[model samples]
Target chain A: MSALLDSVLATAVPLDRALLLAAVLFSIGLAGVTSRRNVLIMLLSVEIMLNAANLALVTFSKVHGDPTGQVFVFFAMTVAAAEVAVGLAIVIAVYRLRRTTDVGEVAALHEIDYGPVRYPQLEGQPVHHHGSSGNGDGDGDAGETGGQPAVASEEAHG
Target chain B: MTEVLFYCFAAVAIASAVIAISRKNAVASALWLVLMFFALAGTYVLLEAWFVAVIQILVYAGAIMVLFLFVIMLVDLKSEELAVMGAPRFRALGLLTSALFLAVAVFVVLNTRETFVAAADTWDRGGALEVESGSAAGIGHYLFHRWVLAFEVTSVLLLSGMLGAVILTKRRLT
Candidate 1:
């Protein structure tokens, strides 16, 4: 018990421990993002990734006797806040219209449809929504920037 | 002594993380994630990065997760879908990439032999234990002196985030 208590006290020994732990957390978050269907849960997994990165930055900063990494972690925290704000807003909008946040349910924005939608199309390739009536109004095209798949493509059609 | 404690927290942190990913219930998964953060923070403290550890708990486990919970509660995502997850190809890719990363990490750890070198050079602890880095004063001095511009920039970023969040959350002008 005392040994456990000793570990509980934070110190450099724990910092190295934290680095290893963060690596594991980072991998688990990666797995969660890959496997999960719920879009919101997937976003949470992204948060886990950011935190894991923070763990690494802070650990190394201390190890090297430098504070620059912590400053970077500060920036990461800020970016994370912005991402959550935008992402959750988008998720709420999609949920309001489609009544679900499941990736499979939002099929109206599939890869096959990518011509008429006003929103940016998914990067790299235009996905044409399968079976979408070719309205030719750009409604068939969906694009996502920054690797976050765009939301409410179904609502755009409905 | 310290090595043993390090391994213990390391194990607990890794286990909680695996549980967080594998748990079926989303809420349960989030809870496990919170535990993982706490354990991670504990690890930070052990490293003598007290400020980072405190900030980790305060910002991540505290503020950020609160936002996540709020969003989870607010969003109704229980409806069934045509597909629950992506193609198995993605999963295979993830596993392959992560396995490669783990192999690299193991190689790096095993090859590096430099654990302790310069205590007498910059520190007088002489292999004795010390909690806070003697450089804390220097950190504060730099933050207030040379890094003031960056500090102000962070304030601007926070302000923008608040406004952006409000604009994003507000109903669109139909």
Candidate 2:
């Protein structure tokens, strides 16, 4: 047991370990952004990426005993806050129009006609048909669906 | 003791990050992300970056996460709709690509061991006097003095971002 502990301690240099953790976290965030269809979750993944970058910055700051990296992290945090504000506003706007947060549902510019994008998960329910006219005005056409009333009322509330 | 603590924090951070990304529900994902941020804050403390650690908790775990949760609630996705991740093939491809990227990053870090060691030696030679660099006082000295211009720029950026968000979300201009 002592031998195992010694090995672990000896191998775990704080700087290297922290960098590795940042890298892993970054890759996980990348996976999240790529796999998740929900725009909100994608934004969350982006935050993860920014946080990983901040971790790396702080780790390097410690290594050099310089506060510049920490200052940069402060700026990064500010930028991230701003980004989330704008991004969530955009998400809310999109959600208001589409009534669904799925990226698949908002592919008004995908350049391919898949015959009214289908949500296999929401089986037997009315699929939020979009882009069938191919005019790239999916938002306007979305009003024809059954979910339109709720979105309209929400827009009015806003 | 520090080594043990570092490992514990790293483990928690990684585990929570994995869970944060994998959860089907955005609210669950946001909550797990908060846990991950806390773990990362612990790691920051271990690194002696006390100020950064505090900001990590305040800005990330507290404010940013609350914004995420608010949006999640506002969007209010049904459980069935939230379950619809992308196609299995795309997910597999993404995971594979990120795994490859991780491999490359780890390789680069390992190969640059000598460089990092040299940097550490330099710090030991002259940087020890500034050991308080991670403290709020230390950081403030640089932020307000040397980086004041950048600081002002950041304020402007924040102002613009606020205005842009307001314009984007407003239902009507009148």
Off by over 4 Å in 1: A1-18, A104-158, B79-83, B113-140
Error (Å) of candidate 2 at residue A156 is 28
DockQ of each: 0.19, 0.29
lDDT of each: 0.64, 0.81
| Candidate 2, CAPRI quality class derived from DockQ | acceptable
TM-score of 2: 0.80
Clashes of each: 26, 0
What are the chain B TM-scores of all models? 0.79, 0.92
CA RMSD, predictions in order: 11.1, 11.0
